[model samples]
Target: MKYPNGTKMIKSNYKDNFTSKQSFGNRGMTLEEDINATNNYYVETDRAIIHKKPTPVQIVNVNYPKRSAAVITEGYFKQASTTDYNGIYRNKYIDFEAKVTKNKTLFPLANIHEHQIKHMESITRHGGISFIVIRFALYNETYFLQGEKLFSYWNDKLKGGRKSIPYQAIKEEGFFIPFHYQARVNYLSIIDKLYF
Candidate 1:
């Protein structure tokens, strides 16, 4: 499968060497898996209630062998999703999308869709906290960029501005998520500092 950055994700022959407890390093686990683990930790601890939204699928065909389980033979996405994760934290609604890029210099704006941007804007308009979690996989750094800041870049791009947000700009405007043993992404710590 190809990642949003247009790079194909090949099955790694080294995957079996690492266990879940030892997968925090840059090459060990993917950004998505790390964040999901972190969210699981948060839920188990009752610190927050966040979850990855399941992609809606439209099943076109199914097959059933006699007295056996059914299998989906064909399916397609129902529609474009708004974001990846959403839930409540500190009595306020929290919503955000997570993305990973191998690019070291800039995060391509094309990684975000227009409808998703609008959805984030709506969240902010309704008093919910909205942001994006971006991981520069090559650098092993994750950042939380607020929706307003993202909108600035999206707007600029729409007006013929730069097509990508420079890494330096993100470093300046975004909050760095510290990695920890219990919380892999540790994004709630940043939310605590920024939103709480």
Candidate 2:
């Protein structure tokens, strides 16, 4: 099976050693899957209505099969997306992009596009909540970094500063998201503390 982040989950022979309560394998679950599960939990409990935006696909051609449904012969992404998730929370608009990096020292700013940065800036300008959920897969840690803070790093790069946000800087500026069994990322709780 593949996780939402497109990582394949390998079947291990050591499954018998793990308890039912255990979550993930030695590599852990992808950030995308955890966030999706968290959003589902939020929606189920009426806490917030959030969902991962589906990527727009342009169908180029289709083939009709004799015994099965039509198959897509060619397709392409319509465009690069602005963010991963967006929704209403406590009467406020929430928008954010989720990103994961395996680097241990820094998060390369190029992972985020210029248009996405502009979109985030627009959201914050209009008084909506915007941010990025960056996961350091190597460390198995995720952090919630506000849009404004992200812009600072982005702008710095444009001004010939560092082209990445160092891990130390993120640890100091971003809030660590706690992992839970049900909520997974549990980022909304940090949002409650930070914004509400």
Candidate 3:
């Protein structure tokens, strides 16, 4: 090829046809983002209505440098958030918390709060579907752990037992959620099998 300046471009020996192996992973997308996309897809298709619960924040100060622009200078959480998400699926109330951990061997119980556990318990008691979406980022795998199973582990930890749930145990007991193009975190499928 010739340049506009009348200079000849030299061709290098780099392979132009080389292709890298395609990976079926989430590709740097966070667990929340994946779940949000999945929820969007569900809402768009009239499959279910789910959304990320916004944390209650008390905006103490706001700076309005310009009329069109406002910046939140100070804010505080009004209350502790119960869970990450809640919605209705197949006429049943769905509530869950989404957590991502880098640990490969186990999921630390410290990541969850006590109040959240109580809330989840209440949800289950009220005939609602309650669960947690745990993502092992190291393995690129997500699992749906039921509230009842989680409560047992929490109780064990409180009773001077293991502080974390083993990844192998979760694999055996929890349901794995596979990634899809539209439903990146297809957790609804697990609900379908277990609930409906």
Candidate 4:
């Protein structure tokens, strides 16, 4: 009788002396889920705090089939107004977005929204560590491209360059985030090396 609303009260790794890393991970879990697990692990270990911003929604209609069970029938995503994940870590601010693509050769810059770019800019203005973790699913490679790097190339594209960031560029300009058991993405390691 477990209805998957994702609001389930799952225990965090910090609850007990859960020192042992869990082998559990999303079997074909979306990149978002993998990042969430990693963030959960970080939060539990008192390492760093990061969270996915809730998707904005505009609820227009609802149906109350039962007194306690009202269902939303008509609604739409209010366009995302900010970056995907961000928070404070070790008394410093950390901001980032996670994107996954099936492409092998390149990552289309078009896939990133302008608003997200602006948000990352704001975070940088405040002296925060900002980055984007891109997963090239086709090659099973994940790279953490610094916000400054992305911004530089983004401006390059605006000044009449390639419409996309080639994978070779990413590999050369970005750091590979190591994957872990409980902390699936383990991006903080990359952050530690590149930022801290």
Candidate 5:
């Protein structure tokens, strides 16, 4: 019997092409893009319905050069945005904010507004799922931190504690999310583990 020659059968360029394609997959994708893609996948697969909440803006002036091209020259925020996204997953209300930071050591507390904290607090109080998705851009790592856990840090900061959560702390407390083909962020998997 003739033995199969694996080395001779494999294409030389296959490894190069595969690695290049894998590297290209996450090239220049912002946190928003990843979440949006994940949300779209969730919706498409009948897993969940989630979307990025639009910022509330009031247009003060508009310039129209053509019927199809109208530009808002001036606008003001109607109110402070509560969070980045909210939706229902597995019959539970899901509310979260997504933040991307270039900081290497810590995530600045200032990145999260007081009002947003209150909003997340309210969601938790009402038995809803609330959390924040923090992405450390330098390391290209995404973490899922529960709102309940975040509240302790916020309270500490208010009481003369560190102004930022150390990267080490997050690595300990937060769930590290792995990227996937369909669910780019795949945060729902974390939710499933935590809630379900």
Candidate 6:
């Protein structure tokens, strides 16, 4: 896989010409990539302690080259990630998922996986700040939807006829995350305004 900038992202495939989509298709980078960049900036500036959740992988086949490091030939990921990012800020536990879509009207509730919902619920139960950073890719707007609000909307949609949450509904329920150069998402500022 290669980033939009043509840099190799993931491990190479055997086929020389095979190049899977590196980032989620929308603008140039995925929501994950954007969040990661923001998090890296935060860490470098000592503004926050958030980090992307690392997936555990087991390497089976490894080839050691002459006078060099070993290369992993085969591996298996253990499980799915519960959340995109989580860490401490001001001694408070924070957890959140980052997502994006090209849809202009609404963000489909189905985009959020059930396990991720459960994980967010768990974070809330433990008194942690849990939310999701959602991007309306076409409009270039991002919102931080709190976990409870997300669950309510998800349940309501599931029990009735609605298949997606309208942008206006999200605008009312979710906090608009301000864009910034340092902390790109700047979600904590929203949290301070809404939940703190």
- Residue pairs in steric clash, candidate 3? none
lDDT of each: 0.85, 0.85, 0.86, 0.80, 0.85, 0.76
Tens digits of lDDT, candidate 4, 95-122: 9988877777999999888888888989
Better of 4 and 6 by lDDT: 4
The per-residue C-alpha lDDT of model 6 at residue 48 equals 74
* Per-residue accuracy of model 3 over 65-90 as CA lDDT, tens digit each: 96578997898766565888999988
Segments in model 3 whose C-alpha atoms lie over 4 Å from true places? 1-22, 77-79
State which candidate, 1 or 3, has the greater lDDT. 3
Cα RMSD for predicted model 2: 5.2
Model 5 is weakest, by summed lDDT over 10 consecutive residues, at 13-22
Model 5: how far residue 72 lies from native, Å? 2.6
| Candidate maximizing TM-score | 1
The TM-score values for the models, in the order shown, are 0.86, 0.84, 0.84, 0.83, 0.83, 0.79
lDDT winner, 5 or 6: 5
lDDT value for model 5: 0.85
lDDT of 4 at 172: 96
Residue 65 shift from truth in candidate 6, angstroms: 2.8
Shift of residue 26 alpha carbon in model 3, Å? 1.5
Model 2: residue 101 alpha-carbon error in angstroms:
0.7
Compare the candidates by lDDT and give the number of the best one: 3
lDDT of 1 at 19: 38
RMSD per candidate (Å) reads: 4.6, 5.2, 11.3, 7.4, 12.8, 5.8
In angstroms, how far off is 95's CA in candidate 2? 0.3
In candidate 1, residue 98 scores what lDDT? 92
> In candidate 6, what residue range of length 10 has the lowest lDDT sum?
14-23
Clashing residue pairs in all predictions, respectively, total: 0, 0, 0, 0, 0, 0
